[model samples]
Target: MKTKPLYLNDCYIHQFQADITEIGDDFIVLNETYFYSRGGGQPGDTGDIAGIVITDTKRDGDGKILHYFEGDCNLSSGQSVQCHIDWPRRYAHMRIHSASHIVEYFLFRHSDNQKFLSSFISGGKETSTYEVTAAITPEIVEKIQHDANAFIKGNHDILLYPDENNPDYRYCKIGDIVYPCGGTHPKNTSEIGEISIKVKGQAALGKQKIVTTLMP
Candidate 1:
């Protein structure tokens, strides 16, 4: 079943209506969904389907988004239902994810777009880290943090549009930087708040991990 991802078009959509397309032993697929299913290092969405609590959502083999219910499950295919995504939780992921990239923008600028070896986001509201092979000096670290915060303060506009040649892939444009992304983000950088960077020692052969925390 092909599920229309309403969230892809509008991340701020918290509630919507849809019909049940299919039902599995543990999950139900919706005709359309604004609730994001886990992918791209982001967690899946949790919410309710017609007042029944939903614990998690995942993508099925055919790419249909699955909504998993909590202790009780009482939904069927072809049934009309209302969807409510946990706005606070979903918004946290968007903010934190955007902040990390905001910091990453400067990180790559200083190092000329090096590959991030490994990265992790702890919980939905904690420090996120990414490892890079670029040289991590004290002065460089300070500069990256400074520039990132400044950009956030500027509230630079962020854009999302599908690639003309390949519609399945979406690109996020921030200033002159454009990269392929499908993750939800704030309309502007101002929502990312202040970002703090902690330079860590060598994590591998020559790569270093930078710990990022969202500060008030």
Candidate 2:
């Protein structure tokens, strides 16, 4: 199995020493990695692995994570290599991801008659969009956005716990609010900064497609 360092700590950006476990025609599998593979709606990390620009990262069906390089490298299996992540990009993702959770949390709380089924982050140049499952109106979207920012301004703490029994575990709590999540998030809500949401067309007859964006 491929070692996933990001799961242990989302903030980890540098791994000076890692062993190359396998290499393929277009990718290399590391014995350990800090790169966050594409999952949970969050984008995979972009950075350098053994001085080669890592263009993409993904996990295979067998759970083996692969790092694809932009250029050729003299790396080999069992060879020690250094890994470095683009901290600013990853941090931005963390902030936006946390904001998304807050938005979902309040949307559910405010719309007690409704429930949130899913959410995903769509990356862009200067901003990331979060598509959430909810039947929200424009006014309700605005209220939820405002309330989420209010919670962010309050600087509520965010925590992550890895359960061996339930490896895919996610739970967020803000005061009396509590919800389940499996994605990475910021340490505190304040780190999320300003955010906005645009209510898109309906996903179905009753479901709304809301796109939440982090303001620049």
Clashing pairs in 2: 170-181
- Go through the candidates in order and give each one's C-alpha lDDT: 0.79, 0.70
Q: Give the TM-score of candidate 2.
A: 0.82
What lDDT tens digits, residue by residue, belong to model 1 across residues 20-51? 99877778789999988887767888889899
How far residue 42's Cα lies from its native spot in candidate 2, in Å, is 1.1
Put down candidate 2 lDDT per residue, 25-80, tens digits, no spaces. Answer: 87888877877778777777778887888887788887788888855678788898
Regions more than 4 Å wrong, model 2: 112-118, 124-135, 168-177, 203-207
Cα RMSD of all models vs. native, in order, equals 2.4, 3.4
After superposing all C-alphas onto the true structure, candidate 1 shows an RMSD in angstroms of: 2.4
TM-score of each: 0.88, 0.82
